[model samples]
Target: MSQKHLTIIDHPLVQHKLTIMRQKDVSTAGFRRLLREISLLLAYEVTRELELTTTRIETPICEMDAPMLEGKKLALISILRAGNGLLDGILEMIPSARVGFVGLYRDPETLQPVQYYNKVPKELDARMTIVVDPMLATGNSLVAAIDLLKQAGAKNLRFLCLLAAPEGVERMRQAHPDVPIFTAALDERLDDHGYIVPGLGDAGDRMFGTK
Candidate 1:
């Protein structure tokens, strides 16, 4: 999956919210609120192709057939702390989605991701799996996370992030072309520190006020 396989959600609302989130002085609560709101919008774009089934139901006016999502429930896998921010908002849109988490922390010296936790719903092969992470900078962690999911039998998968760097996107494309990426913004190069340039700056720290 090259850049062609990536979907940059350039919707006005998404861009506007992302601008606010990128500001240096925004409060933690404000950042969280914007992320949740933007996640709802992104969720709409990503799930546009969901399989639908017709069901007979009674509306306020009369009985009619209604289209509803078909097959197994969707699965949302949040990539640790920052991913949780996007997860909360997406869950609001799909309350029935099964939730999971993959906890990985970057090794300071080597700048590599180390997994500490992994848990996901069963029957992943039967459902669409969306992995959420706020920042896709180095792409190492995202690759590792997807590898774990595939090993667990997840065939259909997607990656969602707020900001993505070219390096990360390319890395993902090479490592897992089968998975399409959905992002709010495709930013400039990653800095030497492995942070996306002009990014919201340490998504987990800003979201949680840890910095």
Candidate 2:
């Protein structure tokens, strides 16, 4: 257990594509496609520290054995609906991993995230969990998602997002300092309306072109 936290990937591939995503002119299809690709790349970064055990596996060519990841019980929890885009890409890479969903919306008056749906794997405690979302603005939903996962006995948790605001990062650090966060880019701040500054706008709407 390491106290060191927070890793904002500054890789050029992530940065360049992240700029394209922020552009207002980017089409919905392009944005959605990019989000998926970005999630795959970002997901790769987030899984770097994944807890893996040494395993022995015989090689096809020789009698030697090597270490391989154990268990297909990883829980990839998506914070719908923007997170669905990310979830798709990650699933492509780790098809055997178990899937979960956490659907939440903000209460206009209280600005609190209300969970409308949550169905996580029963053995959440034994599996490592990855929470995916496109943006982390005020972190209302992210925090709530973490809280819910913790309740489900998910001790090893990692949060992955395409873009994150400073306010969200700070809030998440204060709330979930133990959980590591992986993001494509960290923007300056959140806007007055709680959207990420220079953000692509309501991710669900942008992805689906719905009102």
| Backbone clash count, each prediction separately | 1, 0
lDDT (10s digit) by residue, model 1, range 70-112: 9999999999999999999999989999999999988867779
TM-score, candidate 1, is: 0.97
- Model 2 C-alpha lDDT versus the unseen true structure: 0.84
* Candidate 2 residue lDDT tens string, 56-147: 65677766555567765688999988899999999888888889999999776776899999998888888889999988989888999999
Per-model CA lDDT versus the true structure:
0.93, 0.84
Poorest stretch of ten by lDDT in candidate 1: 1-10
Return the top candidate by lDDT.
Answer: 1
- Clashing residue pairs in candidate 1 are 1-177
